[model samples]
Target: MKFIGEFIMLFGIWLLLTWSLAPAQVIAGVVVTLLVTGLAGDIFVFKASRAFNPVRIFWMIVYIPYFLWYVVLANLDVAYRVIHPDLPIRPGIVKIQTSLNTDMAKTFLANSITLTPGTLTVDIKENELYIHWIYVHGKDVKEWSEAIAGRFEPILRRIFE
Candidate 1:
C-alpha cells in the first residue's frame, strides 16, 4: 500500500513537472517513478491510510495558502530589514520543542520554518527544533516556540499526525 501511494505521488510530481501527455514521456515517468518509489517508498510514506485520509487531505490543501501568507509576510519583513539597517536584528539560534510526534510532521515543520525568509531551521533533536532567526522576539523557549511554530503546529498535527 505504501509503495502504491508513493508511486502515485512520485508519478504525479513527474507529470506536473513535465506537463506532457506524450506516450514516451509517460512511459519514462512511470519507469523512473517506480524505481524511485521502490527505493524510498518506505521512508517517504509511513502509512498509506494516513496519506489518503480525507480530513488530512483537506488540511493539507488549506495549509498551502496559510504557509504562503507567512512566506509573503516574512519576505516583506526581510525586505524591510534590508532596506533599513537602523532596525535591530537580534539574530540567534533558539530551541523550541514541538508537540508533534511523527517524523513526517517534524520534517514538515522544519521545512516550513526554513522556507520563511526571516528564519531557518538549524537542527531537530527529537521534539526540539533549533531555529536561527533574523530577529528573536520571544522572551523564552515557550514564547519562542509559540511565536515560530504555534500557527503551523495545530494544522500540521491535523494533516500529518
Candidate 2:
C-alpha cells in the first residue's frame, strides 16, 4: 500500500513536470517512479493512510500559498538589505525548538526555513533547529523560535503530524 501510494505521488509529480500524455513519456515515468518507490518507499511515508488523509491533504494545499507568501516577503527583505547603502544585517545563528514530533514534520520545517531567502537552517538536534538569520531580530531563544519557526510549525504539524 505504501509503495503504491508513493509511486502514484511521484508519478503524478513526473506527469506534472513533463506535462505530456504521450505513451512513451508515461511508460518512462512509471519505470522511474517504480524504481524510486522500490528503493525509498519505506522512508518516504510511514503511514499510507495518514499520507492520504483528507485533512492533511487540505493543509498541504493551504501550506503551498502560505509558504510562497513568506518566500516572496523574504526575497524582498533580502533584496532591500543587499541594495541598501550600509547593508544593515545582523547575522547570527539562533536555536529554535519545535513541538513537531515526527521526523517528516521537522524536515518540512527545516526545508521551509532554508528555502526562505534571509534564513537558512544550519542544524537540527532533537527538537531544536539552529538557523542562521540575515538579521536576528528576536532577543532570546523563545522569541527567535517564535519568530523563525512559529509561522510554519502549526501548518506543518497539521499536515505531517
Candidate 3:
C-alpha cells in the first residue's frame, strides 16, 4: 500500500522531469513505471522513512546546480589529463574517514565519489571509505579525505542524518 503511493509519486516526478504530457506516452510511461516498481519492490521495499523531513528534499533541489557544476569541473579535469602528453595520473587507493552514521549517508558518499571523475569507491568499512583515485591532485591524502567528506557530506547530513 505504501509502496504503491511511493511508486506513483516517483512516477509523477519522472513525468515532470521529462515533460511527457502526451496522453499515449504518459500511459505507456505509467505502465513501465509500475513494472519497475514491482521489480524493485523485492530489492528495497521502498518505504519512506518515518523520519522523512520535507526540508531535506527541498535542499536537494537547491543543491542540484552545485552538483552539476562539480560534475562539469571533474569532466574537464579528466579530459585535460587524457589529452596532455604527460598523462598526469597518479593512481592509488586511500582511506577517507566519514562522520556519516547511516546507510543512506554512506550510500551518498560512495555515489559522490563515483560521480566525480578520477575517483572510484572501492569499498566501505564501518565509517571509512576506501577510494581509488586516478590522480592524487596534491599527493595529500588528508586533503582528498576532506574534499568529498566536506564538499558533499554536509548537504547529505542535512538530508539523511
Candidate 4:
C-alpha cells in the first residue's frame, strides 16, 4: 500500500516535469517509478502512511500561493539590490534552529529558503540549518530563524509534522 502511494506520487511528479502524454514517456516514467519504489520508497513516502490526508494536501495547496508571492517579492528585492547605486548588500552565513521534527518538513524548509531570492541553504545538521543570506539581518539565532524560516515553518509543521 505504501509503495503504491509513493509510486503514484513519484510518477505524478515525473509526469508534471515531463508534460508528455506519449505512451513511451509514460511507460518510461512507470518503469523508473517502479525501480525507485523498489529501491527506496520508504525514504520518499511518510513512514507508516499509505496515503496523504486530503486536508494536509489542501493546506499545501494553500501554501503554494503564499510561497509564489514571496518568490516574486524576493525577485524584486534582489533586482533592487543589484541595480542600487550603493549596492547595499551584506552577505554572510547564518545558523538557525527549527522545531520541525520530520525529515520531510526540514527538507521542505531548506528547499523553501533556497528558492527564495536572497537566501541559500548551505548545510543542515540535525535541527539546525545554515543559510547564506544576501543581507545579514541580525546575529540573534532565534530572531534570525524566525525571519528566515518563520513564514513556512508553521504551515509545514501543520502539514507534515
Candidate 5:
C-alpha cells in the first residue's frame, strides 16, 4: 500500500515536470519513478498511519499560496535593497531555535528560509537554525527568528510533523 502511494506520488511529479502525453515519455517516467520508489520506498513513504492523513494534505495545499506570497514579498524586498543607493543591509548571522520538533520540519523551515530572498540558511544544529540576513530587522533573537521562519513553521509542522 505504501509502495503504491509512493509510486503514484512520484509518477505524478514526473508527469507534472515532463508535461508530455507521448506514450514513450510516460513509459520512461513510470519506469524511472518505479525504480526510484523501489529504492527509497521507506524514506518516501511515511509510516502506515501517517502516510495518508487528510489533515496533512490540507495543510500542504494551504501552504502553497502562503509560500508563493512570501516569496514574492521577499523578492520585492531584495529588489528594493539592491536598487537603493544606501544599500540598506546589516548583514549578520542570527541563531534561532525552531518551534518544530521533527528534523524534517526543521529541514523544511531551513529550506524555506534559504529560498526566500535576503535570507540564507547558514547551518542547523539540533533545533537551532542559523540564518544570515541581508538586512537585520531586529536584535531580539526570538522576534527575528519569528519574522524569518514563524509563518512557515506552523504550516510545515502540520504537514510534516
Candidate 6:
C-alpha cells in the first residue's frame, strides 16, 4: 500500500513538473516513478510516520513570508557592506547546538541557515552545528545558534519528524 502510494505521489509530481497529461506523458511518468520506487526499495522514506497531516503542516506554508523576510534582511545586510564603508566584515566560525532530533529537521535547518545570507553551515558534528558567520555581531556562538534554532526549529519540527 505504501509503495503504491509513493509511486502515485511521484507520478503526480512528475506530471506537475512535466505538465503533460497526454497518454505518452502519463506512461512516461509511471515508468520513471516506478523506476525510482524500485530503486528506493524502502530506503528513501518520509520521516513523519503519518501518511498525511495537512493541518499540522499548515504552519510551514504560513512561515514562507517570515522566511522570505529574513532572507531579504540578510541580503540587505550583505548588500550594505558590499556597497558602503571599507567592507567591515568580522569572519568567525562558531559551533551552534541543534535541537533538531531527526535527520529531516536537521537537514532543513542546515539548508535554511546556509540559504540565509551572511551565514553558512560549515559542518555538523552530531548535535552541534558549525557555522561561518560573515559578521559575528554579538560574538556569541550560543546566541547565533539560539537565533537559528528559535526561528527555524519549530517550523521544521511541525513539518518533519
**TM-score: which candidate is best?**
1
List runs of model 1 lying over 4 Å from the truth: none
Encode model 4's per-residue lDDT on 36-73: one tens digit a residue.
99999766646435136777788898889989999999
Lowest summed-lDDT stretch of 10 residues in model 5?
43-52
lDDT by residue (tens digit), candidate 6, 1-161:
67877876787799899898889988888888889989894885553334467865686777678788888988998999899869989888878887778776788788889878688999998999988888876656678777655688877777775
Backbone clashes under 3 angstroms, per model? 0, 0, 0, 0, 0, 0
Clashing pairs in 1: none
lDDT of each: 0.90, 0.90, 0.78, 0.88, 0.84, 0.79
How does each model score on TM-score?
Answer: 0.91, 0.89, 0.75, 0.84, 0.82, 0.86
Model 1: per-residue Cα lDDT over 1-161, one tens digit each: 77877888889999999999999999999999988887877666467789889999999999999999999998999989988969758899999989999988999999999888688999999999999999988689999998899989999999997
Model 3: lDDT to the true structure: 0.78
Candidate 3, residues 1-161, lDDT tens digits: the string is: 66676677768887987797889878878887888778776565344652355887777776678778878888998999999998989998877888889886788779877888788899999988889888766546578778756788888788777
Model 3 reaches what TM-score against the true structure?
0.75
Across 78-136, the per-residue lDDT of candidate 2 in tens digits comes to: 99999999999999898888899998889889999988868999999999899999988
Candidate 4 vs candidate 6, lDDT winner: 4
- Model 2 bad stretches (over 4 Å): none
Candidates arranged by TM-score, highest first? 1, 2, 6, 4, 5, 3
The candidate, 3 or 5, that scores higher on TM-score is 5
- Per-residue lDDT tens digits for candidate 5, residues 1-161, read 78877887789899999999999999999899989988888775355456578888888889888888888989999999999999888899988888788766777788889878688999999888899989788768899878888778878988988
The lowest-lDDT stretch of 10 consecutive residues in candidate 4 is 42-51
